[model samples]
Target: MSGRTPSTRLADTIGARPVSASAVVYPGKVWDVVSEDVDLGRAGTVTREIIRHPGAVGVLALDDEGRVALVHQYRHPVGMTLWELPAGLLDVEGEPPLLAAQRELAEEADLRAGRWDVLLDWVLSPGGSTEAFRCYLARDLSPVPEADRHQRDGEELDMPTEWFDLDEVHTAVLANRLNSPSLVVGVLAAHASRALGWSTVKPADSPWPEHPKLR
Candidate 1:
């Protein structure tokens, strides 16, 4: 074996193939369906359909008492009401990821954070979508002022908010009870970071080169 340990060797490989043709097949409300003909070096060229998304950010708000803030919202695609981290799309032009996470925390959880760290970054669905997601570990929590709270609408209206022990959430994740991607990944990443004394956490504004730029 080489000198690289598991920690040093564990990383996703990145490469790009030439796309001969690309077009938007379906323009949806939130995202678009894209079709592309990519040139494979050795293998023959292939056409792929992709979901072009605007990306998103999530916040795992941890209080000093070892509890996490979560929101119960209905996801129509999955047809389930899930306990998930406060999260939102990066739809607003020119808004930073950290700012989006902050806004989501305040809007969905009615909370704010004084300190933020990047907990995890992932591709929501690499096989079918260009949706890059980031999760933040937010601490030094405080309630959003009532006057400044965002007006909830649609699925957000009447959404319930609750606090749960981090351990409880972790157990739920392990038991397959929590199905929200953000909540599952954020909770597990937060747990691992905490176990490592937060040494694995990155700055809230850490460089995100993997996130695709939207036109």
Candidate 2:
């Protein structure tokens, strides 16, 4: 909601054909080419012949000690170590993004938060990918016991978690340590909320005390 929306125009598709069918990427039939006239400058409109993908969710968990939780992992696609907030894809059908954040924290970091609030929900890359990222701020976290932590298979995520003060995390950002955009936005949002003392109270008990935008 911070930036202006893009303008887009779509044209007609004269013909369409299936390119290939795969089990992993496209469980159903996958189309390769299509005849169409599309304008590249617009919003919610595209000339995609293939099936589009759904979006994902991101969580920025803040402890009562005033530190943000970060996860260090190796992204195979990027082929490098990257620091990101605890997050996951909403692979399941019909799952709420904020609730998914709650589940992700418990499973990935062995942490659960007492109060969760939605900070922002926006598309990460609106041009090519159909990925809409929902960012949330979680507070009053409770850690699961060491015996409760379990590592799942098929994930190369060595997410050794750490908590950093806001200033230290901002320093890391300045040094090009953090890469995820959601984390950047989440951290700034959390910092602003904390400064205004908005996130300290439960939303249910004291909803948007002054600002109509927040209400």
Candidate 3:
């Protein structure tokens, strides 16, 4: 053993290897697929194909009654209408994750939150994609004015909003009834954070250094 204490151990390491060469292989409407030759020091150089994404944000809107807001939206790629937290891609340049979460909450759920906290941050698929994700805990919620609501289209046009008890959602997630990544992580994180008196949550404006845009 290196004699390092368990408390001194960090979860994820933050570092980058040198990329000898890189190029986009497929340019898509939302994201792009790229190939890169990375130098791994003694391990030698290796090539990797990656899906370059703009990252995304999700909002766990908790009402005063402890119900969590959710939306049933069609995900064409998955071929299912998933129950998900209000979420959207970070495609808008220069928009902060918190703002993105707020926008998603209003647009998808027709709700706004007065209190926001960073609940969790994660990478969707570290080995295959550059998709960084952030989930926010939102409280003190209120409905947006009817006239101020965003016009929905495509998969969002017929989306339905619902609220469920946090514990119920957590149980559903563990039972495999819910599969949305954001919903799963958000509910589990919310339960754990609540157990710790919400000390696990960070400020809404906390810096997300791991996000591709920020890095």
Of 1 and 2, the candidate ahead on TM-score is: 1
Candidate 2 backbone collisions, by pair: 7-41, 7-42, 8-41, 8-42, 8-43, 11-37, 19-32
Model 2 TM-score (2 dp): 0.68
lDDT of 2: 0.65
Q: Write the per-residue lDDT of candidate 1 for residues 1-215, one digit (tens) a residue.
A: 79765696678765668999999999999999999999987898999999999999999999999999999888888899899998999999999989899888898999989999999999989999999999999999999889999998877886889999999999999999999999999999999889989999999999987787732
lDDT (10s digit) by residue, model 3, range 43-157: 9999999999999999999999889999998888889889999999999988877888899999999999899999999998999999999999999999999999999987788
Better of 2 and 3 by TM-score: 3
Query: After best superposition, candidate 3 residue 58: deviation in angstroms?
Result: 0.3
Per-residue lDDT for 4-74 in model 2, tens only? 66545553232323323323344433222332334444442334442344556677888877888888877
Model 3 stretches astray by more than 4 angstroms? 1-6
- Number of residue pairs clashing in candidate 1, backbone atoms closer than 3 angstroms, sequence gap of 3 or more or interchain: 0
On the 0 to 100 scale, the lDDT of residue 142 in model 1 is 93
Give the residue spans of candidate 2 off by over 4 A: 1-51, 146-150, 199-215
| Residue 138 of model 2, lDDT score | 81
TM-scores for candidates 1 onward, in order? 0.94, 0.68, 0.95
